[model samples]
Structure formats: structure tokens, C-alpha cells
Target: MQSTRNKLIDLLANNQDKYISGQHLSEELNISRSAIWKHMKELEKDGYEIEARQRRGYRIISFPNKLSENTLKWGLETDWLGNTIIHKTSTTSTQHIAHHLAREGAKHGTIVIADEQTGGKGRMNRPWHSSKNQGIWTSLILRPEISPHQAPQLTLLTATVLADVIYKETNIRPYIKWPNDILIENKKLSGILTEMQAEQDRIQYIIIGIGMNVNQTIHELPDDLSEKATSLRIETGHQLDMIKLVQAILEQFERTYETYLNEGFKSIKTKWESYGFKIGERINVKTMNQQWEATFSGIAPDGGLLVENKHNGKVEKLYSAEIDWFRE
Candidate 1:
């Protein structure tokens, strides 16, 4: 039902800056005159500038940059990714809501988005700073037909897609840190958290929580994060329209995900290596019981980090390791 209204808005927006008659909308949508009027009024209240003339009917003047379903659906061009969006002004976490929905049988491509998250989290349970209407906090649900061992490739897929989207939108060269973090000029710009549910051989679902700092400024970040966090606005010296960024991400992700499932992770890994952070650079790493300086090579086939320790000149695959890229 709501998707129908969104489709109506998409139609009106397709002819933006031009008049779309109410009668035409009613006929096309198979709704009555009153229903069209009611939906138009609602759109007007949500910061959409619509001009209604008796003879000319209606025209959309502008659209807000909010992440509401209507706004996102206006120009979205994806087949399924983010087609069913659950949006919140403020919430505990989109990841939590997505998990609940997935367990309750939410279909693939269901998206949980929030303008602000009261209890957002990142990899290793780190607190994610999500300011109100300042960043992109969303979770995507996927039910892929793959084994548990092949799940890590989804994180890599997300990293490559996000890196491409950021570069296309802002023209900023985004570097993908080994597993999931995205950096720019050595400052953390975005992060991806991929969690999955699986049995012995079958997979239930995977929820990918993506947090990207979009329009926040240096002053908006906390004192501790001021030195390490950066936003797109801060990097570009101007505010960006969040709707465009989100739409682009969805489109690119859908395409990349389809490619991964159809082709394989070989191409995705190649793209990830193109923007990889500090390739061939020596860096300090600390695992649970070992610490050493190793020369970073590239990603392994299974999405693990490959590095050669300086002590023995032997290379090993690291699935989980803390890296110190700033060490001299």
C-alpha cells in the first residue's frame, strides 16, 4: 500500500518542474480524486514543494534531502535493494531492528534505516557515533544461497561497493582498510559490520550494518573522535545531499552483489585491492598472543589479510588481527 504511494511520488517526480495533472495521476494510479489529493497534501507536509493549479494540476518544485521512504523511492533505480525501507527518526540501532525482522522472515533487500541511533555499535562492539540527521546508519538484509565459510566475502563486497560509491559521489579517494573500515587521509570515514546466521551447511540470513559519516563537521564529533573521525562534508568543504548518496549506494551495492553471486569474489577482490590501504607497507600487528612488524601484501582469496613477518620472512594469513598503521 505504501509502495503504491511511493510509486505515485516517483511518477510525479519523473516529470519534475513540469505539471502533472491530478486526473492523469488518478487514472494512472487507479485512485480517486480525493485519494490523490490526500497523498499530495501529505507530501507537501513532508517538505516537498508541490504547486497545484486548477487547470495545470500539480507540479513538484523540490524535494527534501531526508531519508524517508517517499524521498528515497523518488529516484531510486534498484530492483530490490532497499525497495522495502523501514525508517526511523531515532532508534536504538538499525542493526537490531533488521535482525528482528530477518528472524521474523523479512525478505531479502529489506533495509532498516535511522536518522539517529541511540545505541549504535560497530565491529568489536565499539560505539558508533551517529548524530541526528548527520550520517548514514542503515542495515541491509540478505538471504544468499551460500555456505557459512563464504560469508566473509559479503563484507568485502560491501567495502568495494561503498568505496566506488564514495568516489563517484564525492570524488574523494576512499581507501579500504583490511577488513571493513574505510579511511580518507588516514581518518576513519565509514565502517561496515556484517553478521550472519547459519546452520551446518545452509545459511539463514546476513545483516550488514553500514555507518557512513556524511554531513557532520569536525566540531560535531566528540573530543576523542575529533582526531580520528571525518565526514564527507568536512572532507569536501560543503554539505551533500544524503538522499543521492544513499540511492547511489543502493544501486551500486545491488549491482555488485548480483555480480558476486553470479560471477564470484575474484573480481570483487581485485577491485578491493585497487583501493587497499598501505599495500606493500610494513606495519605492526598484534593478535591475541603475538606481536610483530609485517609487510602487508594483499587480501587472501578467502578475504583474510596476507602479511610477511619481518623476523622470519614467512607470510601467514590473518583472519583477525589489530593493525597499527601509524607505527614508525
Candidate 2:
């Protein structure tokens, strides 16, 4: 069943530049004029300024501009990746909400977006800063029947989706700081946080949180991060339609996810490696106590870093390490 409120929102957003007549809306959507009026009143109650007049019918003046269902549905042409949107004004973290939603039997492709996340978490337990109206911090819940080990592949796929959208929108090529961090010219632009609830053999649900520095100015970043982090606006020198960016990302991810499901990772492995961080370069890494410089080989078939130590002429597969490409 199509909801009248959502249809109205879609109509207004799709026709942002022109006035959509009430008779047309009623006829096209198969609803009555009084019902449309009731729905418009409902939307007004939800902070939408839908103008009504004698002949002009209705026009959406303004609304909360974010990654809401109305925005994604209007912009995204996908079957999933935003089928169910959970929006909050402020929360501890969208991932937490997604986890709870998953526990309560939420469907796949459920997305949780927050305007401000007080305790926003990062990949390695780092505190993610999510102030009011500064950036985009959201989480997506997916239920793939694969095992826990295969979940990391979703992270890689997400990295590819995000990078693809960023490149498509800004025409500013960004680099993937392996595992999953989108970088622009060498500074951090976005990070992916993946969490899961699984059994010993089967997986129940996985929540992938992506925190992007979108629309935030250079000075709005923390002092410690101002030198190493950048937003889409800072990188592109203009503010982006954040909602549209989210829509684009979701659409790309939906396509890629379906492809990965139907065709497997081998189909996209070449594309991933093509955009890989370093092709043939000697890099230094700080694992835990000792720092070593190793020749950067390509990734293993199972997605592990292959490094050859220069001093010993020995090779080892690294499951985890901080790759220091920048000589700082």
C-alpha cells in the first residue's frame, strides 16, 4: 500500500520548480481532494510548509533537509538500501539504534540516520564527532545469510560504493585508505564502521555505519583533526546536497550489493583492485611495537594485505596494521 503522505512528498520534490495542481495530484495518485488536504495537513504537522491556494493547489515550501524517506525515495531508484528510514534529531549513535532495530526483527535494508550523535563510534573505538548540522552520520542494517567472515567483504563493497558516489558527484577522485576509509588527496573524508549480531555459524544481522564529513567547513572540525580531515564541501569548495548525496550512495550500494549477491566478489574484485590504494610502492607500518618498511604487494584473494619486508626478504600476510603511506 502506498502512503498518501509519501506520495505527496515525492510529487512536491519531483516538481520542485513548478506547482502541481490538486486535481492532477488527486487523479494521478487515485485519491480524493479532501484526502489530499488531510494529508497536506498531516505533512504540515510534521514540519513541512505546503502552500495551499485556490488555483495553485499545493507546493512544498520547505522541510527538514536530510536523508529522510521522502528525500531518498524522491532521488533514489532502488528497491532497497533505504526502504525503511529511521531518523532521529539526536541519539547516542545510529548504529546503536540499528542494532536494537535488528534485534526487534527489523527488515533488511533498514537505515538509521541521525542529525547529531553524541557518542558516535568509529572503527577502532575512536570517538566520532557528530555535532548538530555539521556532517552525515548514519548506519544501515543488512541481513545477509553469509557467515561472519564474509561480512568484511561488505565493508569493502561499501567503500567502493561510497568512493564511486564521491567521485561521481565531485569529480574529485578520492583514495581508499585500505579496509575502509575514503581519503581525498591524502586526508580523511569518510570512515566505515561495521558491527554484527551473529550465531556461531549463521549471521542474523549486520549494521554498517558510515560517517562522512559532508558540508562541514574546515574550521568546524576539531583542532586535532583540522589538519588531517576534510569534508565534501572543503574538498570541492562548495556545499553539496547532502540528502542527494545520501540518495546517490544508497542507489549505488543497492546496485553493487545486488551484483555482489548475484555475481559474487570475483566480478568486482578487479574494479576494487584498480582503485586500490597503492599498486607498487614500499610502505612503512606500525603494527604494535616495531615499525617496518615493506614493499607493498597487492591484496590476497581473501582480502588481506600482502607485505614483503625489505630487510629480510621475507613475506607475510597481514590481517591488521596501520599502513603509513604519508611520511609524517
Return the top candidate by TM-score.
1
Poorly placed runs, candidate 1 (over 4 Å): 1-3, 14-21, 53-56
How well does candidate 2 match the true structure, expressed as C-alpha RMSD? 2.6
Write down the lDDT that model 1 would get: 0.91
Stretch of 10 with least lDDT, candidate 1: 1-10
TM-score of each: 0.95, 0.89
lDDT of 1 by residue, 1-328 (tens): 3476787788877898689888899998999989999998889877898889998998888887688877887778899888798989999999999999999999999999999999999998999999999999999999999888899899989999999999998889999998899999999999999999999998899999999999998899989998998999999999999989999999999999999899988999899999999889988888999888899899998888999989999999988887868465
**How far off is residue 132 in model 1, in Å?**
0.9
**Cα deviation of 222, candidate 1, in Å:** 1.0
Tens-digit lDDT track of model 2 for 1-328: 3456677788887887778888999998899988888888767765678877788878888886655555555546778668788878799999889999999999999889987999998877998888676678889999997878888888888888888898899998887767888888778989999898899898999999999999889889999999889999998889898778888888898999999988877755666676677646778866877789887776677667778888998877776787868364
